[model samples]
Target: MAKSVENQVEQTKVLPQYVAALVANLLVASVGCAMSWTSPTLLKMDSGETDIPASSDEKSWIGSLTPLGAVFSPFLAGYTADRWGRKTTLIATACPVIVGWVLIACAEPARSIPLIYVGRIIHGLCLGVAFTVIPMYCGEIAEDKVRGALGSFLQIFVSLGSLSQYAVGPYVSYLVLTIFSATVPFLFAVTMWFIPESPYQHVMAGEEQKALEALQWLRGTSVEAVKEELAIIKENVREKMENKSTPRDLISTKASVTALYLSMGLLGLQIFTGIDAILFYCQDIFAASGGDLDSSVSTIIVGMVMLLASACTPFIVESLGRRILLLISAAGMAVSLALIGTFFHLLNNNSDTSSIGWLPVVSLVIYMIVFSIGFGPVPWAVMGELFAPNVKSMASSIATSFCWFLAFLVTNFFPTISKELGSDYAFWIFGIFAVVAFVSVFFLLPETKGKSLQEIQAILGG
Candidate 1:
């Protein structure tokens, strides 16, 4: 049995393969569709096209409840990912969103608002799982040469999915949109079975034979190379797992504690930068900015910019490196948001002469462009790169839970801030956060570009 395993590991490898990354992103794309589905669906319901017209409070609840559900998903998904393997957990998570789409499809015809809320919550759970698992899977499967590109797919497909909703949702029947959305997760589940499981997961489970097979499929390398990589992975996994990793052990090790703090801090900064808030209220921002474009058209424009920028990231992440891209993105976002806030301040103060009426649109486009290139995609990419194998699930769960919790807070509270202190204050506050994010990247964030997962852990002092 040992000789047979050695012979299998000694087989020549294939290089530059992407089956794992491609399939994982397909699933991530489904979560993206779920995230943005509420935007146009709510718009349609508020327009009274549905059997039951939704009240404003109901609309808010529907929009906010997604993050609420996300708060619990990490626990379920983290355990499942660690226990069942990343591929199975991802396939399982897809079931909830598929069911969510069905409920959404039925709600309008049946005149049941409660059903739609339930659907949103279910979709939220899908988001939580996708955020946790896809990055981990991609990080594990990708070779260093292609790792940056693979990692970037998590955000790229998300942009594409959101763009799809902006483009298609407004034009289709609510039922038709729901049906279309349902197809993504269904397809994701079917396609994922073909991809290799994460080598890290196999190593952690002490299935060295399975790990070698998975690495052969993923790395496409010589048996020697496969064995070499497997040795490193095994050593890392054995060292970490030997301690019987627990929640307390997560903070006990310096590496574990650092990984936890870095992941949580990046996620926090990602939200506080206010891109999610901007996305959530794109139409209202445009309406209040006195732009000549229709709100829907302007919103689509925003989504397109985000999509294009995200598409560029996979091509550039390796060349620019994570820290540089993050720095550039953060500085640009800070300036763009500050300019946008200034535009709103001028408009609010009755000082915006007609000449610069284009400022808001210009600033917002710039903001989204910069955000997509760096902050939008990079944080999750980094999260996947950090953490030891034994503590990954627990650490990821804690970090992901923090992300969803803060997302809920920001999405829930931004409206109140806008109402009480004015939108200018909210934008300015986000701008400040952007500046702080830049400083954090410069002073604290470690560069993970072109490094192996084990290498990243080593750099973290694991």
Candidate 2:
């Protein structure tokens, strides 16, 4: 027992630096998600539209750009991270985020529709890079026992960042919000200079001693534990070296192809379920659902609920496990969507009286809670775990980029989809997707509970 306690202490020594880097990464990631939240609201206000897009054609075109950027940027970011190192890739991507925000803040003054699209596309590109790279960094740095917890927290901070935007959006001008959003990336870029690069990247670069020191700094472990961790890392690196090939060779391999497909499927599920569309247009959904409010105060309740659910994720994730939580959350979302859809269906049928006055509001809130709990966090966490180190960056980029593509699809289509199908059918479509996601999680995803990064890699046949 005494020896075990000593071992624990030794294990903890390398954690401080890692925690610092994690926090920095979280800040940047949160900002990236927040920018997405803020952009739609700012765009609507700047455009002076009574409803988002104002027309179906306009909506589809605008929404399509998001996925277009998402689909492309990940490949670029992922390859870049693998080639240049995660730190450099992240720092380089921050520049676009800054530029995107500046364009957004200047939208009214600029009065250009093309500029808004450009800004959003740039923001989407930055998001694609940040999402893929940050998770890879966190997963690489974390101790085995804490990896899930740390990786899961990335989504939590993303929620926090998103919630911050929703909180501030109503109270502040679009210009101020855009400027504030841009500041986070700039700060993240500056601070990252002080953080150490990933130990895995150091190892890949053949800096064995530097890699050991990095692991030591990241783990906060004693020298002996550091050595043990170093041995594991070294073995993993050697395996990767043995299997090393050009990107084309890597892509041609069966395991790599399987991992890529799984990544893309996971991301596609995340977007197809309509969460981003819901999140981006929550206020509009609420208003359409019979809640009466102007654009400014429209989604406050939904945003608050989303924020609360996001806050609860870290607490529940470990206790419930990713699979169970996701299943439960997905089930809840399906039920909520069904309820909301029913309400809309009733309203569409009746139109004469307020028969289901409270149903829409109640159902929308329930939908938001369900989403925040399950689909929002779990997909990102799973994506982070699904790939091995050799193909991690490429796989994650493909997944995240696809996620954005789907996000673009859903967001762009929702307004028009909602208009044509009516609120009832549009939500039902999401409900069906949620059910599909639940099944996928149950059958397709492996139990990654308490696994080390290398263990996870081994499971995936790295």
Candidate 3:
């Protein structure tokens, strides 16, 4: 027993796949940085920090257009991931982001709102593609023992990048911030070249030897051990191909229907909870709360809380299970958001809000922490695990696209909601959704922790 435990530890210590997952997720971090760009930059622009001044409507366009790009980019990502392979697809996704950053760097100095808008749209396209491709790639490449942890890397790095941006963006000039953002993807593209392609992608492309080599490299195991894992991957791939699924087939089958429902529900949970809109306008939300603290500093602190919370999941997910974490997350989010709303409710009513000025900041920090624990990362982590190999790309693309569409709606309209309906009401609406998320996870979400893709499918009745 001791020897076996020791060997397992030894195996874990050398798992190359985890490293590969980390490297790929650097690009995801770049996406996170890009997504959070509006938070500080918008504030600067509104204050006339830039050469070109933007109106309220133009700022909305800059903030919301990324999801618009997300709405359309997933089809391209899905096609490319399967046809060209995962490594190439990730490398390709960087191009648009890099270009977007370059445009932003130029646009900042020129005060060119048009260039900035175009840059934001292009980055949004990259964001959409990254969301679609990286989860699938990470899910395919990781061994079952470490899959949960590695898959969660997507969110960890995302949170890290977000924190990095939040910490730095407020203090930097617009051109410097844009230039810094552009450097991340350039680094990601260069580093990713050293990692192997997903073995699953190679298998799907009928390159058995290449698949084996990838498996060998990823597993860092003996040939025989690698072969056994490869056989399982190939068999799963073969079975999925035999049942080859389409958009039509996904609905024709009970398994696929369940998978789609779960995917969509999880994606919906991620957005409707108001994280994207809140993050996009973090400084504004803080400013509106009438807090004594500097809104920029508070936003940075919230970003730090999010980063720390996300960092905890990979270690605990397999033990505590997905359903419980998600339930806990949703419930916590509901409470925090409600408290935040109450804070605003009292303040708006001209109640003595001075003593309770701390409430909004504390509540938001709790909200960010809870959200980071589950909704922020788990949905994307679980996405690639839910579908069979044949339909994974297609289903994920659809779900990601849908997720972004909801994001576009929420982000574009949030200011309107907060203004006309009151910020308290906007938060209350998100709390209501959080409560619904709790119920949904309790009844519908199956635990995929520590399970293989085939096993997960069987659990979902696929």
Best by TM-score: 3
- Model 2: weakest 10-residue lDDT segment is 49-58
lDDT of 3 by residue, 147-189 (tens): 6787778788878888878888889888888889888999999
lDDT (C-alpha) at residue 179 in model 1: 90
- lDDT tens digits, residue span 237-343, model 2: 78977865556844666556655666677667767777777667665665566644443354655666766777677677777777787788778878888888777
Candidate that beats the other on lDDT, 2 or 3, i.e. the better one: 3
Clashing residue pair totals per candidate (backbone < 3 A): 6, 13, 1
Model 3: lDDT to the true structure: 0.85
Taking every candidate in turn, the Cα RMSD to the unseen true structure, in Å, is 4.2, 4.2, 3.3
Of candidate 3, the 10-residue stretch with the lowest lDDT total is 5-14
TM-score of each: 0.85, 0.83, 0.90
lDDT value for model 1:
0.80
Highest-lDDT candidate? 3
